[model samples]
Target: MQECDPDHLVLAIENGEFERASEILARDCQNRCVCSVSALQVTALQVAAWQGRIDLLDRLYEKGAGVNDVDKIGRCALYYAAHRGNVDVTEWLLQRGGYVDAKIGVYSCTKGIPYTSLTKACFVGRKLPLPVCWGRTPLHQAVKNNHADVVRALVEHGADVNAKDERLVTPLLLAGSATDRDDLKEMTKFVEIVKILVAAKAFVNIIHPDTGTTALHHAAMLGSAEATEILLSNGAWPMYKCKSSGSTPLHIVASTGSTETLMVLLEAMLPHNIDTRDQINRTALHRASYRGHRECVRALVEHGANLAATTKTGTTVVDAIFAHIPRPLAFITEILDSCVRTTNNSPLETYDNVLLAFGYLIVGFALSFAVLFHGNDQFRDFWRAVVRTVVMMMGEYEYEELFSAENGRGTFLPITSRIVFFAFIMLSSIVLINLMIGLAVNDIQGLEKEGHIRRLLKQAEFVAHLERVTSHRIFRGNWLHPRLRMLLHSRRDIPTKITLFSRENYFHHVNHLVESPSKIPADLVEALFLLATKTFHKNDNLTGKNIEIGDTKLTSILSNLEEQVRELKIHLSQFDESEIVETARIQNKACTKKTVNS
Candidate 1:
């Protein structure tokens, strides 16, 4: 085998000169040095196998090429053959001692994930389950690359259809979850692969232990109506919730805007399943509206969904739309000419006023008693003075007793007592009571005029909430750091909830690692809101044009109906004028005769 030049052999193989490629191999006994026959990274045998050059592969094998020869990673010749969809090459490779369970080259980096127990060193981390195969098998590569024939060949040769990768995603799940190019023909190919896997008895509801996605969930996510239908027909549970999001396939469909697939699921659903909520109590309607899927929202509503359904945080579908939909003022103002409205109907408003008045009355009474005690007092003690003071403040004082002049008592008290009492009367009884009255009256006057501003504030808060929900959804599905979501929401197990009212907590919640929730800088805020507003304006403009077209069609129909009504009235006039007049004349003559007799 060392007598054969590696460079010349590779050149012949590349140029597809199979005859010369085969002849370049030196005559070799069956027993030869193993490593010398193989090249550095990819052996010629593997290349020929991947290229589907069966004749060149046969020549290499006769020259002492090992069928089980692997690259630096554990990718065998069968792995390349399987990935390339060359079933005949895969069969030849496997028949010559290729192991089905050999790991593929794709996961070469993830091999031998050591079980480093930090718990043994300190006590924090955990013992993660390292996959023994380190990840992909030949079958996984075949299914991932859409080599359906290779998939069949391996499965028939006793490959594990249920083999799990590092994330516990199986070959069957991988097939359904192939990154869609959005081509219809590619979609059909995936559907066929799913059918093949299902015929092999692949488990339909095996959740990826990491992502918690099932085969059905993956198919739903793919948005292929036919693939979803096939999975459902094969006992895929549509209601199985993913552990990560606690969302069923129905929620996935609504979120993905897969209306056709949604219809397929809905037609097979029981009536009670229509309003199923996810973990956050967001119904499919809420999902559709939050994402601005107008048609999906309409379909959900037409199916008798509860439009007023609330999330766990107490927001309804209409609320979601109002809060999140950009340019909501224009849309809402059309139906509500006032744009926004508020109602201050709480009973507490009046109760607050009453409390304010009572508090001032107590303060006034206390001051009057304290002043009366500073000098001469008509009463025996401070308590007596306080009683008298209360009476004087309410305008029910006994004026005759203070001025009686009985037993050396004069018509007036000393100057100090008189001045103190009079000042108390002015400060407490007059000034303080009037102040409370003014405040109460002011509130009443303002409520009537401030409704519009209150409404605007309410609309702003609604829009902000919409922005928050949309951003949260994006982070959950975005390719960014999703762990940042923990800051937005409090965890039950964490102590963040304890500081809910603390200043530092409020500051951090609004300002830490993010723009302030309410007061982002104007330019940045505009940029953030611009995308939402543009989508809204585009959609609203389209909607307006559609409405105009419908209005034109409606006008033509109304004109036709008006002409028909006019023609029908003319026909009725021609039939009954003479007969109607004669009847009226007879009735008038009878009435005049009866009146004269009476």
Candidate 2:
């Protein structure tokens, strides 16, 4: 008998050349040479089973191949069979004492349930129960593949429907996320699967460990209206709060910008004031406004969302929108006007001036006693003398003349009396100035503290106001009309070259041209003309015009163009190759023109 090369046999099996592999195995019958099947080979057999080549797998098994052989990372044949929905292969291997408890692959710890071969085949509409080596049960595979038939089959076979993976994600959760059931035709099967799971008593409100989101939360997030309907009908609670964000399903819908999902959630009669907030105290309206979801904002408003809601930091939904949306001046003004008209027209005269004066008098009396009783008697005496002198001087001289030095001292008194009086007056003046300075300092500090508090309050109010206004305006702004028109208009002109440059620089260049169209320096004008020509002929070459420039200037222009191209490459990496080439050509032309005229 001929000897079989282990490598060639393994390759043949891997490539699905089962007949050739069988031939090689037959030829090496009498050599007493054994061929070891790698874990990859076992996986290949599972793939073959998926293709209905059961005969080939049988031959390989008869050739003394280890049914429980694992791959490099410890994944066995069962892992592949379960993953590919090969029920017959999985069942056969399991019956042959295949390791049904082996953990394989990255998420093995999370994939707790061991599915049977029958379950695996049922998942993808196959009718056979193939055995597998790894511990993942057929029910687990069904949920992973989102195959309703397999899931139903496994349930019939006594598979636990509520079993969770290492990540705590249940089979029901997986089915809801696997498919996009937007079209009615595609939704029927998934709807049936959900009904089956619900009938089997699967946990309808299972939350994921990482996101703390339930299956209902995921459905809302995906904008799958049909899935949402199915879940809700099957007793999936819409008000299930996400453990992480504390957001209800409606909040998730609003933030995801799923208009259909939002409408569905609203129609379900979920509590309008769910008021679920994220860690930062940002409500659904705050998220919708920040993301510029006009429809979501409108939905929230119609559902009685608090327009005056503020975040933990006192940022209102309006403030967040204004901070993000460009050219917010007109938008903000319009919002403020609307708010002013809607609010009550009561004047804020709550502070009574007479009461304030009385309070101040009481405070002054209290402060005087405290100072007199606390301080030294000598200091108190000095203060009293100063106050008396100030009052006496006021009585004798005109108040204005005392303050104004230019006024003459018209009334003459005894020389000794005047000296003593002047000395008293000087001492009183110094004390009065010092006291006034102290009061001024205190007033300034108080003002500064008050200003800080006012600024914070104003910021919070502004954010709230901006959020309210933007939310209202987003719905009323006729936004859909402009967007639809823009989308439908195919003849929209491309932006001009001048528009790409900074507005200030472009204005300066244009003004220079208008100021002295002819007197514009020949070289400078040539440079401008060259740039303009390149702009017009962006997709083509320019007409005849040659201007020689020095190497230094040419090098500078080339360097600038290179820098721009580098930046453009970074920004436009996702663009097609042809687009990148076209952009490069335009940049090169601009650089050449600038260099030639420089």
Candidate 3:
């Protein structure tokens, strides 16, 4: 090896010249040499670890190489080992007193590139060559490189799985967000890394301070179904809205058009949460429809997403989808068809109206044929008269056909026949036709009025179906959450004998009669109490008993509630000066006092 080239030993180890590397390190055992490679000044031990040569690594360590020696970028040999996915070297280094949670900072003043100033730049605006790997531990590097084995080894050696980089990204978040590449093997490795970290009790819900995104958010955005499932199964909350966009994981998955991932998320979500809106009051359905994600839209609709959900500005999902000019016909057709199916009754009802209209046509034909049969020879045969009336009703024949003498000698018809002909024309052409149109118009207007109610009914039907399916033996306890399963099977757990309510349950049952269950104005509370008191007094007079209000405990509770109502009235008067407020206040006071006296 050349003495002038300090990188000779490192290059020899990289090229599988382990014999030469061993000789160079053995001869220079008193001083371990460092080499400048790829703008990073790394020691020979770091090179051996990066190359995965345990023989050369052991030789360098025997020559008194520092286990925690950092390079120009502040990364140690263990960082390189983990970065290259060298599991054996990583394990050996850790066993030999290597720091497992060592953080690396890439900024240095020796590079002469405003290292301190650039480090202070925001992540969005920074235009540096290297990423901001400051504060990133060896585990972060391993997870970022998609090295599952290295990640496992580092984590086993007590690596900080939740350690964050300078950008506030943990190892789990980095692994979940590694979606720049589309390689299948890389994705598998990412899943493995995520599984290992989560198993080690990594914080799955750590939010990025800058972007307000968690590991679940990143996994949902990437559409990684396996990673998302693992995170959710490990207690990652799906309903936590991002602070920046105020969107949940469901919204992100829908916007990305990930149908499989969206299904996985839907399984973990509740029914009422399906239409949760973000900061702009836009639901996942709104995002999916706007992006023209047909499969996602179909899934959302089938899972009971509200088609009529609107934004704060009153824009609905339909309005967002149709806003595109030169409209997408297939997408528009899909949305319209879904809306009609969910919101309208069966078309069979409309068809019955049409059938009724056609029945009236037959009656008009019989009436005309009966009267005209005796006046004209054209109507002498029943079949011929039927054909003539049908043609005239369709406007295919001239009016002269009825009075002309060409077909079977009729200069003119009798007065009775003429009257029947005029009546048939009026009934068929004017009355029956307009009546059919009126029925269609009425049906359409009725659909509009009952559209919202039908949508709710469809959702209820879907819930009922889901409940029935989940109540089966196979899915009884294996599929749903424990709390939901308890709710579904609660009736089965009840005993044969009816039991009286406990003291707590009894108090809860009648608690609302004393005051409003939720926070509301004092006027409504007063009205409720007054109504209850009057009902009790009336029942006492009718039943000849004072069982409802005879107890001293009940009277004292009512009196205390009346006092609380008075205080609430005072609070309302301080902020509201409107006439309606004053009226409500006065009415509340009089009602409360009257109920107390009674």
Candidate 4:
């Protein structure tokens, strides 16, 4: 028998000449095993399954062909079966211990599940179990693909209906992106899946990790009216705000151009003031107007979106929207005409009036000062009076008239008086200026002291918030970074670097400093200090401590610092004398102790 080449084998598989390929495998290639069977044979089985050749699949499976074998792309027969919706072939492969969760190609491993494949099939109106890769489960793929039967099968087979993918998007969230009728029909299956998940007590309002979007938020964002309706009917709360971005479902809907989705969201009983701003102080109205979403803008206006709302830069939504328009004046006029007519003071006009008043006051004061002391005679007289007052205040009046009679008669008297008066004027001016500057310095010092006290109070409040967040035992020794933990437990004597304080005695001493602070509330810091001290004490070398300082700990520490700073700003509002003194005393003592130790 003549040996079959790789090209012939592949051609036979592609042309569906399975009988001829089998004859070649049994006769000419019976004693010869080609590695191409693992690759080419898998492709043949996939093609057979795609062409509905059940007999071909069975014969190949019986020919000692590798069921779980992968091609160059790592896609196996089972991956093809599941992907192609060949239930019989998929079942057969699964029964043969082929990994259902087997990763496909390297590209699939990184790019995540084949959503495009499933979605395209769904668009063409095919019903098959959705294929998944990466962290996405079949349920998520089915919902994303919008395949009703596939979604149903996946859910029935115990696929996690509420399971989040790498982006933390659940199956319900994926279904919300469906736009076409085929996509919507498939999305209907997600409605049932959502119900199942809700019944299972999955968090319906849980936020996604990436965008911090909830299922309701996703539904609102994608303009999925039916999905939004289903979610509401199944007790999904639309008012639930994302924890990270702090955007509610209404905000998402109002920011979108989808009139139907917006209507569905608006009809749902959301919380009052649902169009709240996020960290950037942008309302839903701002987004709608900026995007030129006329319907969304109108909906927002009808729902009492504040037209006069301004961002941090003091630009009103109307101002921003008008500024971005190509024909600004016309659009501005149209929008202003639609606005509810009311009498209110113009902010810009008020600002101009205030600036004018300030300018007038400054010019008036300068002119009045210049006019009052224009003549040298009057100036001399004024300086003499000032000098006399200063001399009297200092008990040196005897020296005040030392130059009063330096020359004889009126001729010399005028010259002597002028010289003495000018000297007195210069001296008095210097003294008065120093006095005024001293008063100003005192005022500034008082303000600085107040600010410092406020900052301390803020630090205390931040420590309180940190204490609240790390109260759980599971979070113990896990939430703070090593540097932050070291900073929190930092002693006056130890350097900032861990390597510098890696010495057992120094580490123990620093631990004492942290423990000495009665107000330090972070358990992670305390735990880290305790563990590090104990570990280092037992073995003077600081090996393996690096592993203890995980990235999560660092992230938590940074979060605490930010939260503390914010709290300190709030604390600045309530400054007190006693609190300031106590804080100063503690800080001073800490400094003194550190200096002595160092």
TM-score of each: 0.47, 0.43, 0.49, 0.40
Least accurate stretch of 10 residues (summed lDDT) in model 3? Answer: 120-129
lDDT of 2 by residue, 1-598 (tens): 3227554555565566778767776786642223433322233344444454667667766766666765443555554555565666666766676655454444323133234322332222122233332334445665666566545555655566787555666767766555664655435556666677777888888877877888888777767777788778767777777778788788788778988888887777556554567778888878877887766776676666676788889998778665654334444454445444332222222124333543454344333322432242322454553443335534443335432335223323335434544554554455544554665666567668779999999999997776544433344356558765454332332322221122344334334222322333434544544543442221122112112223334456666767766775564455555765676678779999999999
Question: Ranking by lDDT, best first?
Answer: 3, 1, 2, 4
lDDT of 3 by residue, 1-598 (tens): 2542446666666666778777777677345454333335556787678778888777666667788987656778888788777898999999999999988876454464345433432131111123356888889888877889999888888888888788888888777455553677877887788899999999988988878888888888878899999999999999889999899999999999989999999999898899999999999999988787878887898788887899999998777765631234445566567666433545566668667766666656755664555456656666666777777767654657665556334533457666766777787788877877886787777878789789999999997777646545565656778887787778334322211222444335334232324444445444444544553343333443444333543566567767766775574455433655566678779999999999
For candidate 4, write residues 495-550 as lDDT tens digits. 22221112344334334232222433344444445534442222233334533444
For candidate 2, report its TM-score: 0.43
546: Cα error in model 1, Å:
17
Q: Pick the candidate with the highest TM-score.
A: 3
lDDT at 253, model 2? 81
Query: At residue 158, what lDDT does model 1 achieve?
Result: 83
The order by descending TM-score is 3, 1, 2, 4
- Candidate 3: global Cα-lDDT? 0.72
Residue 534 miss distance in model 1 (angstroms) = 17
Q: lDDT of all the models against the reference?
A: 0.65, 0.57, 0.72, 0.55
What would the per-residue lDDT of candidate 1 be over residues 51-77, giving only the tens digit for each residue? Answer: 689877777787688898775556667
